[model samples]
Target: MKTKAVRLYGKSDLRLEEFELPEITDDEMLAKVVSDSLCMSSYKAALQGGDHKRVPDNVAENPVIIGHEFCGEVVKAGKNVAHLAKPGDKFTVQPAMFYKGSLEAPGYSYPFYGGDATYIIIPSEAFETDCFLKYDGEAFYHGSLAEPMSCIAGGAHVNYHTKFGSYVHEMGIKEGGKMALLAGVGPMGLGTIDYALHASRKPALLVVTDIDPVRLARAEALFTIEEAKKQGVELHYVNTAEKDEAYVMELSGGTGYDDVYVMAPVKPVVEMGDNILGMDGCLNFFAGPTNTEFKAEFNFYDVHYAATHVCSNSGGNTQDMREVLKMMGEGRLEPSVMITHVGGLNCVPEVTLKLHDIPGGKKLIYTQIDMPLTAIDDFAELGKTDAMFAELAKIVERSNGLWSAEAERYLLKNAKPIG
Candidate 1:
């Protein structure tokens, strides 16, 4: 089979090319990628190339396809894995398959198994590790989003707290306790808020802070306080640009927060999260810093006296991905809020290389189409000259300006096919 994909040749060297895919062995299956959500980690991999731990050292000679968070349909199921995956089965993969303790993963390490392609061969290691997940969700984008959402879920699950004089640590955020998300108006932060409100372990008070008022407004509009109140959560969105930590502490009744999450890699954001910890407060440094020497100051006095602690997770495990899929299927989690831009396979190389400079949540790509990267908010403006964008603008407008399964279907049916 022939596949079109964006491959990384070296540092910042990405090319979208069409190549013949080797026939899958009996131990492998083939899939047609439908939707892939671009991630910051992919940008890091492109920048570091072979230097990235998950990226192989021979990328300059043997380039690997880019993109990890993807969902697709099975085109052909090999005999060995036919029972597990049949032709036409919709699926998503947990790309962090720590197969046999190797850091090699699908998007970063595999030449024929990444998400930024029209077709891919699923290797045996994916099924062996049980990372090949069958998705029953209606939208392929939902399945693609399950990977990132799982990371948020895993972050919440990894937080730990202690009881007085007890050596044992309790997993998960403090239930019915005050929780704060610092610099939390980004895409991942939005997912974190969605999971926190819908997950079984609910926080009594949730405060999300960001320096950007525009982002804060958008977040508030997406996740309204009235809706949070129905879920028994006292939710507040604050622009930290104008207010300081004292103002946030006041919202928590001056007792400080029980669970504080720092969503930005900025040093002050980390310090802010540390300063507002209550007794047994667990600070989750959720952001992944590019710099190896990234450091932040924390109150050692609080660590010694207040029992404040810290934890973090890079990506979610298979189980966490399963939980996200379950939640998405049950209509309990809406991860579409994380997406702001949409494009096609032709745009993958440019978008993936310049992802850092792009101002948006998630950039979703349909691997079979040929369209330029465009923002959802710009649909109405672009609709003036294009009939497709006009119809899309109307569809998303009916869905409250968010991308929907309807939009996905419309785009796939009407957009130009990839060359």
Candidate 2:
């Protein structure tokens, strides 16, 4: 059998390549990828290529599958496997897979497995047993968004209650009271918005701040702004880079935000996050700082006196994936509003290299799946335009189609015949 995967040959050297499939042991199951999404961490692994700690140096010789977020359909199961791991069932698999004996892991710990590929060999223990309710990718991406949505869900559950000042039962500190979003734009930021909008009742306002004028324009043009406004909540897009202090003050009515979450990689935003907090505001540093080596200073005087808080989250929890999915199904959230681009698995690596250039709300990497997908046409969106388009010209020039969804389904449906 054959399997095609997106490999990280070297820094900026991610490529979609083909390979032969290994025999599956009786304890293992063979699955074809139905969908996968790009994460910033994907880029990190690619930058270092196979030298990454997750993938062993040996497998690094092969392209380390760059995707950690993905879901797939079981195509084959070993004889020893039970009915529970049967074929045709959908799941958002755990990216890491270890060897039979010693904790000698292969991918991640080595390079035996990773997403951004057409197929994978999954062991029984990598994932939680509760498959049905977990981010039902079928509902969101026709089984496409299993991984991406899961990450959002994962972040939500990563210590959901991180000291939010004081806990008031009714309105104050309530589910839908007041929340702040700093630098809210792009897909990841929008995911945060969607989570805050539908999942958390903490912030009723759901203030989304961004420095990009075009992004702000597109949000309203897209669906979020109007949706947030229609819901009787405030979705304020602020320009922090230019008039940082004034805008923050104006939005809070001089009270400042109650809960602020930063969604971009910018580090200086930390200081601004501290300043924006309303009394006892719980600041969520959602965005990853550019490089771990650098440090940002916080005002000790203000921190102690005001009792402001600052914390962050990594990806999200598996349980949250279920919460996000159920919310989507119940009509409380719509990820379709944020989707702006779609492609097959083959285009993943290339598309990822140039993701910064592609303008618009969200880019959906659709696996060549037979299932239905979600899209928002009339929603204000940033479409991939031709050369004349100024906003996304650079992104257009830089984006690559490494592992495309079409390529994925092709590899899977026509899976390399097992020897």
Candidate 3:
């Protein structure tokens, strides 16, 4: 089968090219990718190329497709798994296939098995690891976001210890506990907010901190204070650049935070999160830095005296993805809140190259269409010049400016690549 994709060859080398997909064995499956989301990790991988830990040594010879967060429809099923794979079945995958103690994740390590392509073969290991999942969400983008959301879910579900020798452990964020997302309202932090708001173990107070006013405003627009009040969640969006640590501490009524997530990789931010932890507070370092020698200041005093422990999770497992899908299906979680822009397959290469510089949340890509990576807010402006964009603007407006499945369908049906 012929497919188009953005492949990674080496550092600063990403190419959008057409190639013939190798035939899958009886133990494999092929899927037509519908939606893939750009991530900061992909940007790192693009820059690191062959040096990336997950990237294979043969990437120079056999370039790898360059996305991990995506969803697709099953187009072909191998004889070994024909019964489980219906031709038109929609699904998302947990890309972190920890096969036989190996750290080889798809979208970085596997050839012909990543998510950037229009079609990809689900390798035998993926099936054996049960990475593929049935998706019943409203939009394909929801399926695409399942991976990142699953990572947040995994962090939320990490068990905590009060003492080293203690046999008992605490599960999730404490029920009705105070939580703070330091350097929050970024793409992944938004998913954590969604989960914190709607998960069964709800937070009584959620303080979202960010230095950027634009990001804080966007986050407030998505999750309004009024809605938080309705749900009985005392929410505060603070611009930390302007506010002092004392002001932030007062937001939680002086008890400090029960849970603090260091969402940024900056050293000061990480250290700041460390100092704000309450007794038995669990600080989760959520952002994974690309540099191997990346170090941050930590307060060992908190660990010894205050019983505050630190934890970090790289990615979620298959069970985490399943929980995220279940939450989405139940209408309790809206992972699509992570998306701020949409584009077609052709947008992949450009978006991958400029992912970090892009000023917005996650960028959603439709693998079948050929359109520019246009921000949802820009549809109104583009509509003034082009008739097709005008139609898309109406679709977006109908959904209150959020990128919806209906809008996506309209864009795919009418929009064309910018000439």
TM-score for each candidate, following the candidate numbering: 0.99, 0.75, 0.96
lDDT of 1 by residue, 1-419 (tens): 89999999999999999999999999999999999999999999999998899999999999999999999999998899999978899999999999999999988999899999999999999999999999888899999999999999999999999999899999999999999999898999999999989999999999999988889999999999999999999999988889989999999999999999999899999999998999989999998887878999999999999999999999999999989888988889998899999999999888888998999799999999999999999999999999999999999999999999999999999999997
Give the Cα error of residue 261 in candidate 1, in Å.
Answer: 0.9
Q: Which prediction has more favorable lDDT, 2 or 3?
A: 3
What tens-digit string does per-residue lDDT give for candidate 2 at 190-305? 66676665665535677677878877766655445667766666777666666767667777788877676767766677777777776666666666643657566666775777
lDDT of 1: 0.94
Clashing pairs for predicted structure model 3, backbone only: none
lDDT, residue 352, candidate 3: 86
lDDT of 3 by residue, 108-170 (tens): 987787878888888888888898888877788889898999899999888364646685777
- In model 3, state the lDDT of residue 283: 89
How far does residue 305 in candidate 3 sit from its true spot (Å)? Answer: 0.8
Give the whole-model CA lDDT for all candidates, comma-separated. Answer: 0.94, 0.56, 0.85
Task: Provide the global lDDT of candidate 2 against the true structure.
Answer: 0.56
Ranking of all predicted structures according to TM-score, beginning with the best and ending with the worst: 1, 3, 2
- Indicate the residue-level lDDT of 243 in model 1: 91
